[model samples]
Target: MSYLRFDKTLLTNLEESLTREVLRTNRSGAYHCSTIVDCNTRKYHGLLVIPVPELDDENHVLLSSLDETVIQHGAEFNLGLHKYHGDNFSPRGHKYIREFECEKVPTTLYRVGGVVLKKEKVFVHHENRILIRYTLVDAHSETILRLRPYLAFRSVRQYTHENAQASRHYDEVENGIKTCMYPGYPELYMQFSKENTFHFQPDWYRGIEYPKEQERGYDFNEDLYVPGYFEFNIKKGESVTFAGGISAIDTASLNDLFTYEVEKRIPRDSFKNCLINTAHQFLNKQGEESYILAGYPWFKCRARDMFISLPGLTLAIGEVEKFEVVMQTAVKAVYAFMNGETTDLKVYEMEHPDVLMWAVWTVQQYAKMVSREAAKEKYGQLLKDIMTYLADGKHPNLQVHDNGLVYANGREKAITWMNSTVNGRPVVARTGYIVEFNSLWYNALRFVADLFVEDGEFSFRLNQIADKTAVSFIDTFLNEYGYLLDFVDGNMMDWSVRPNMIFAAAFDYSPLDAKQKKGVVDIVTKELLTPKGIRSLSPKSGGYNPNYVGPQIQRDYAYHQGTAWPWLEGFYLEAYLRIYKRSAISFVERQMISYEDQMTCHCVGSIPELFDGNPPFQGRGAVSFAMNVAEILRTLNLLAKYDNQ
Candidate 1:
């Protein structure tokens, strides 16, 4: 269950990261652009991919575009970009972004496509057909590439009710969408393109055939529309620039978000790799080091991203250079926090803010996987600095808990990465205190404590803190159902089974006995496991549903609850190996190591956002994600090498 170090393959990717173009995929299913600046030529080159939905409805194509900048109610005052007279969707103020409504058709919506970032922020200044550039971290020595995707919609209408009439008259037009240049970075110019061929979907549910691309040809949810595609041009080798579709805006308001991507994200180029060449048109970016927590496009920032992805992506692939870059990034983020920008309460978020205990724990695990005594020493200091920060109490009036869990926030709400919103309000605030963060805290301290117990500045106090936390965790978080509550309070707020416990089992630092660990694993496996991976919740839960693909609004209702997610599979498999004490993996492990190859067959390589809750179902994908591939590779390491190790 320990994190695995990177290998030659990962090192190759790391070297590539220095000169690689970006393959960016938003939540919506579209390839906005694939951009690269040839190192020899210094020409910014890019390919924008727009996957035609095989759905009979042509408008389904635009589903991706609308999702990227779909308009929402009342948001007009803030993030929405205004179109024509008064409509708006903007990327600014939309990081922690979730969904957007389909205008012509109420049933449809768009989501960003996938997860993966290989290079730093490479901005483009594009006007007319001529493209210019901004800033980039590596173009000086290595080639740089950046890409963005968009899906056009053709099917604009959907059933108002589950079994209602599918017939509705609607018009598709370019409402107010926002586009712009990176502020102060004149090399990058941005603009939104209105599709001339928007209406391509049938009025009703129909399937599609993709003769142009043989690898793809299928229908997910009969009701679909022509998807939109985002086009971006980066003049070769400039400075760093960022751009993305925004949701919610007015002409003036929407226009304001032109600087959304560039202004918000920090430039980063920690690592790289390119084993993956294509994604279900929606997702084509390869797996590298990625942070999928707080923002839509991370122009260039590191912290939670530096930590969360360290194990599965970085270490497993042996991206030592990236290892150093992310370590530096994490340290810088901690410094930024101490200097006053990051909030202790908000730092763990993948998109923004302070640092996360989970990240700290991940670093500890990553250190073990990396296994170099010197690297361990260097990161040991980094971990020690983090503990010092925790002891300093990272926020206004915040202090360490009795158990050494950092005082996350004083507010009773405001969840971190697992954040969910209903009607634009954080539904799970998860403030005041939390279980998983502390579990990570305890494990991280233990891992670090064990690292240099007899060496310099060792926190033997860390062990005492972890002990107290372990007792508190067992006494407080256990539920009557014999399963770990998703989280805890005076009364368990979530009775649903979840994969969060894998962190404990994987780390083996939590004071869990064989029984407790097995109990946690068993409960989750029995309650949340599906053929694909772990479900966010048990099917018996109220929100559980087997259907995975659908229109935007309805999809959210049951999403994560019963949807079979592949990202959690690696953790689950590792937990299985750890629990069963499998010294030598079986043939099953060998076959499953081909998880990516198998998953690619679905909707054909689009590793969906999640699979349907039911069996005998496939291709219900609304989004293509990167974590699944990364996790698969992680699992592959376990079977092909790590288990043997």
Candidate 2:
């Protein structure tokens, strides 16, 4: 039996089918997303969404969806699903869905009366393109397939309407048409594999409601433009493909191009293979450099996420060349920031100061895979430049204190990953010397100091600073509550039992002693550990909010309060293995293996962003989050490394 195939019993259930979503992405920053049954329920759900550099840097929805119809013996069967105003599902095409499977790609089979049809979708890598192939499986008579394209031509954040200002013209290309409805946007070229006629008719598809957007308390209704339709005569055992992209495509070799792309994909036959395939999709190349995209559906290349995910997403899989490219790209961003030059290094603007420290620690991880001498030869200057800028207190509201610990404050909201604001105020306003920040600071100082050991004076100065920071770390963050204090400003200490405390044991050079390390792990395991990950806040803590639901404000308030972030599992497992040593081999394997079942359950092999803190921890964030998947892959690598005694 296929591991990821869904029969009609599940696909026909509209409520169950709509809850599961599928995503396909290309290296050119384009993606196709929709429900398992080809029904769109979110504003972010689109067949072709890409970054329009001329208009803005964010993604714009060009082609929202394609409605397909099959006709046999003068009888028509609608195989498309849509939602309109007043919670109505028009055409109700999901009832014809016989099966849905996601192995190498997402494929759906539709059985209308006696005619069997199969549809396969794949996003072309390194290009802004989507290919959809339709094959007639078991048709007794000749059949015709009709495809209607629904164009949004607006930013994903906004809805379009039936306005007169919109353009309604098309230019003929290859075997199809090209159109750009708005100014300052790239035109899209759409083509079919066979000879076809495009009827010159235009109409408005109005009152289309997105249920996911409505739940988020945003305007969910929009109007789409349908530019006629394409009709093709399909026969049994014959296949036809539709190509959509920003530039004109060669229709003659379209099938060959699709075949080449499909052949390049890695196998996804097992749980581990599925993860490997998903991990390969996160890296996108532009010109001579490559960067890691934070997540799919709706995310950009963020600096903090890139650093955090680089080691696992690249190095752990023996992708040393790509790893170096990503590191070089990030370091260049820091260099540009220090020199006050215009840069494309768009990280989280209100980022925690620890992100820079994580970049340094990532270098240390890379050194283990390669050699320190080799790393120094390639990245020595960039690393030194970053440290010099940090020591000089160049960044906003961030400074190295006289006591040697880094102090990052004065921001209206928190700067770290927990920096979620509700109604213009940070929900968890932690402003001070955060525990994780100081731990990373101490490790970075020591690691960089070791790199300059041949230079005596520089090495001594760096080690001296790290030594002082170690003393301050114990005095300020270690507490009588059996765990580390979350953060401190002046004499005020925030003793919230959060997962941030685990980093002290997980870092390359933790200041905590053996007794202290065991104490930290014990407290975290008892209070914050769950099957999915560690909760952001302990249940006993006053600020703990178990559910992450509701509108923007409510979700923000609960984002870091008690939501369980699966990305933290990497650090938690690393710390546990550090304190427990080789005795943790069996335990680690069992715990990590338990998540294999989850691969088939949610998002089809990729992990999600977060889960509820309560029991039965239902996933509650983005469907296929890159950070969570990277951490899981890193944990598996760690287990293999430590279990081989």
- lDDT of model 2 at residue 514? 84
Residue 419 error, candidate 2, Å:
1.1
Cα displacement (Å) at residue 45, model 1 = 16
Give Cα-based local distance difference scores for all models: 0.42, 0.83
TM-score of 2: 0.97
Give one digit per residue, the lDDT tens place, for model 1 in 56-99.
31111222222222222212112111111121223322332232
Candidate 1 at 356: error in angstroms?
Answer: 2.5
Please provide the root mean square deviation of candidate 2 (C-alpha atoms, Å).
Answer: 1.7
Worst 10 residues of 2 by lDDT: 343-352
